[model samples]
Target: MTGGAMDVLPAAPAAAAAEPEADEEADPPAAAALTLSPADSPPAPQVSEPRAPDSSRMQMPPGNPLLLSLTLQELLARDAVQVELIPEKKGLFLKHVEYEVSSQRFKSCVYRRYNDFVVFHEMLLQKFPYRMVPALPPKRMLGADREFIEARRRALKRFINLVARHPPFSEDVVLKLFLSFSGPDVQNKLKESAQCVGDEFMNCKLAARAKDFLPADIQTQFAISRELIRNIYNSFHKLRDRAERMVSRAIDNAADLLVFGKELSALGSDTTPLPSWATLNSSTWGSLKQALKGLSVEFALLADKAAQQGKQEENDVVEKLNLFLDLLQSYKDLCERHEKGVLHKHQRALHKYSLMKRQMTSAAAQNREPECVEQLESRIVEENVIQTMELRNYFSLYCLHQETQLVHVYLPLTSHILRAFVSSQIQGHKEMSKVWNDLQPKLQCLFAGPHGAPSPPRSPQDGLSPH
Candidate 1:
């Protein structure tokens, strides 16, 4: 099999394109175009008249060699026997040995740098938008250590296995070329094929209509998640701000109490009689002032620490939620692209089939050239095959999307759990405050002597006077 074997032939030139000459006959009364909607009732299988096999007909060449007699399970039986990170002057390369069940029949080694994998994954995503392309490992800035390389090696193997298991994706020309070719040839072929696929996808009319084909329920779910995430982020932000303000006020009050205690101590023994509720021994007052200052400083430090931690935690949650939303959006976009490509191809095939059928009927009536009629018949067969494949690809994508929705349900549930957790923590803080308030007076009384005057009730304004 030649490298870069395309599954579908390139589109014929527009001018030379085969179309029933409209003037030849009134356009065969316009029949309804085939509807490829996944939700629609399945069409009854067509039964064709039995015919003798024609041995004289030439055998068609296979489009892709990887599709030849290889089951997905058989391909996946190949294992990564050894993985190594080889350091080169330019950078690092990941090398691995693949051993098939029959070692003698199939054993090979492959090498790919990190960037190569990244490029390959991107191309795969573009080419097969509906397929669940396994995610690459997160990017690491630092050079590969043993653990990092080992983890990446395992991830890469899993990714390869996933690709191999997917029938349509496994037969992708780029993937086959990448695995079998080496050096510059692999890179060149992969790049060329990627560009071709990309260009074809871009030109597809279905791309424009892809969003319309999305299930309404999925769209609604996405909208709900987006709104929920936004609300949670804003609510948490506001809660963080209010908590900080309350902590700030408490610290200010503590400082004021410390200052008022210092003033009372400065009044001295010769001072005019202090209010019975306000009088205390100077030594006692001094100790109280020091304790207040210490407690105030400690509370301030704790508040700062708590505020930092709370903010950090809130940021992390919001980030994760946003990431989930982003992932959903990305998946939808990929689905749209996949649907567009498949639908576009299917439509084109339908168009060709219609044209050929009309042209063949007209040619037969006019006793026209047999060669032209044969060509038209051949095209009809080819278009039918292409249309069948496209339909299969379309339905597969639809099924995949439906399965993915099950996974998407978790996003909103996770958000709800996180929101409840935050609320519970806030409630816990409120309960702690109530407990502290109930204990404050009892704690103060423990420090008072039996003959000593009771301390005046502290007010927010009491201790804030400047020296």
Candidate 2:
């Protein structure tokens, strides 16, 4: 009642006090003949037009982000994307791993030091998306176009020539095959295709027909039909085809599988090439020596650590070193004795001296320790001089047949023997001397009784031997 709009409507005209009679059939003019305009026809029955789907809206179902996940690039840039990773189900990843491991070349070469670079590089490239990069041919030929082909021809020719300097290509069987062809054009065509490594012209059927063109010498060397060569080539081709298929499959899924595909795609390409170990170089020798030195140092430290920690390990290292030292001493003794015996045979001294020099050079190259290397070199020089002088002395003894100067011959021989004996004793002492020296103090510490009681006595021989 307080609202003003309620009172604004004029009060419905007061109902007339007298009512007029209405015809029963006419119901008050049928409610005054109501009519509706097009706009007023109950709002045109409100035929709800189908709505267009919302273009800018997105929705995700509960517990699943599949419908509304971020793009891979966005995921990568996130500071932390905690994903509940499940173990891989068996399929292509496992299959490729098995294939790779089962391949003999992969097993022997892929995991080793020298061949690993090639195997791994090739395998990674084959297994990764990097393989999608198309081969971009070299802009400039490394050699003349025909140069490579001619080089191959020359190499094959050289091999055939070495077989007997016979013409391997222009033999009687080949001539007969050409004659059978009924024209020189076919022969020229065959020659053209033969230059290609895997061309079908080199097939056995063609070779059989051309057998008359081959010389007897060539036939004797090859000893087989062109078919054999073709089959061999085809077999290799099949192998390569299979490998390519495997490589494609491996690459397709490498991202999630961690199969290292990028390395595989580099096979036979300019970008990814062979490693240093695959080729020879003087620098590689230096690297090898450095690696060996590092390994030696590492082993030495390991031995020292083991010595400080465990009695068994300490003994094991000492025993192995002792064995190695003993073997070296034996080799030195054998070579020294052999040199002396060879010197007595002056007629053969020159040849024997060369052999001894090679052995000495090898020993020098192998010896790495500063003191030991110098000592060994000095010893080798001394032995070489002794051997030389003895040769001369024995020659004089032989020519003069005199005992007066024979003592010179015997003296040098005796010096070598004495040196060998002293070296042996010194090496033996080096191997065993520290065993007790180090153990005595450690034993004293271990034996000091609880509450600082006096240490117990140990046998004098305890820990004296290296092993």
Candidate 3:
């Protein structure tokens, strides 16, 4: 990742890398290419041979690791790259909210429309059907305002950053072309690259040997973590909504204060024809009118302060909450995929294998012709291949381990968010208290200057300062 394209992704064996358009993993090693002199190579994993089912313990046929050996830090890609999304209105009438996705990991800037994100997400789901693929932000056609566009941009940014940081997805031809290819038909290129590519189990390489690295109580741990993350997501989601509502109220209050100030100023400026009540107490009225006019300045200033504080709350609290929630959502998706997607497929494969085994046994026991028994045997072999792939996927706790580790690695973000939230709250309360403290003396000076002694002069450094 530190180097340019060549350095980030090593070329696969030359034969596999021949097509500039084809993915490195698109074409499996040709039969002839794998056919070396018996003395030149050691025996390969005998995947074609059948083995008895052993339900007592998890196991996989020994095979070469599918993926290159890399440290956890390398896989996380924490400091390796930066993903930036600059949004611009590209349509002639501002109908299109286009995003320019730029990354040091890719060759150049790629402008992606929301539709492009849609296609890219679909490809991810298709390629890694059982893996946790985060959902894209909902698309809308009629409402593309600056606010909506900015929110969607943030969502899309999170989506791409997560994908870019992932070791497998980072080097994936789908992602590489989506980010780098300068061609007009990027959607087509994405679709093409997704074809012929194997699933995550094939790419992960360590999936078959997951039991060797994972703990014995891996299932229990995954369940517990998933439950914990769900609780956090639910709680934080409510917190974010409340924070947003609080900011909205601040904005509304600011607008109301401005209106109040204007009305008060109008009352003070009415010298055209004094009302009967005003004339009855002309001396009192005249001075009171002057104070009323001056009230506008104080109210307007307070309104501005409220508006500024509202923006601070949004950045400090709501944004941070959103970030943490996004991570939680992804983890939840992983939990769901493991149970409903991968587990279900694995069960179905088992059922199919059992059915084929029964068919072969029945045919052989009936004293059937050799051709019939051979045909039944061949069908059972085909079913065996399906079982192997499914078994690898079912036991692939390695991906789960990486994802769980990723959650812990990024969990510190929540603490940073909470710190910022508290700091903003403290700052906001201090500002409000200062406003009331400063206003009391100003009111005494304006309304009681003649009748009562003027308030003691304030010091130069009377304003707020951190203790």
In order, what is each prediction's RMSD in angstroms?
16.3, 51.4, 12.9
The digit string of per-residue lDDT tens for model 1 on 142-205 reads: 6656667665665565566555444455556666655655565455567777663342123233
Query: Ten residues in a row with the worst lDDT in model 2?
Result: 96-105
Residues 1-467, model 3: lDDT tens digits: 11121111211111111123234224332122212243322223223333333222222334422223344356445323334445445677755666777767554687778888899989987766544467788887586576776777777877877777665566567777777877887888899876655565554444445545544445455445544555566688898899899989988988888888888889989878777766756766676678788888877877877887788888777876776677667665665565445555555555565566666568779977655677757765655555454445434445655555555555566677778877877877788677767767556544445455655656558755555
Point out the higher-scoring one by TM-score: 1 or 3. 3
lDDT of 1 at 267: 40
Candidate 2: lDDT of 274? 41
> Count of backbone clashes for each model?
0, 37, 1
lDDT of 1: 0.45
Off by over 4 Å in 1: 1-117, 123-128, 132-292, 308-320, 373-381, 408-412, 419-454, 458-467
Query: Local distance difference test, per candidate?
Result: 0.45, 0.28, 0.60
TM-scores, each model vs. reference: 0.41, 0.14, 0.71
Q: Indicate the residue-level lDDT of 381 in model 2.
A: 56
Best prediction by lDDT: 3
Q: What's the C-alpha lDDT at position 109 in model 3? A: 81
- Runs of candidate 2 exceeding 4 Å displacement: 1-411, 452-454, 458-467
Q: Candidate 2: what lDDT?
A: 0.28
2 or 3, which is superior by TM-score? 3
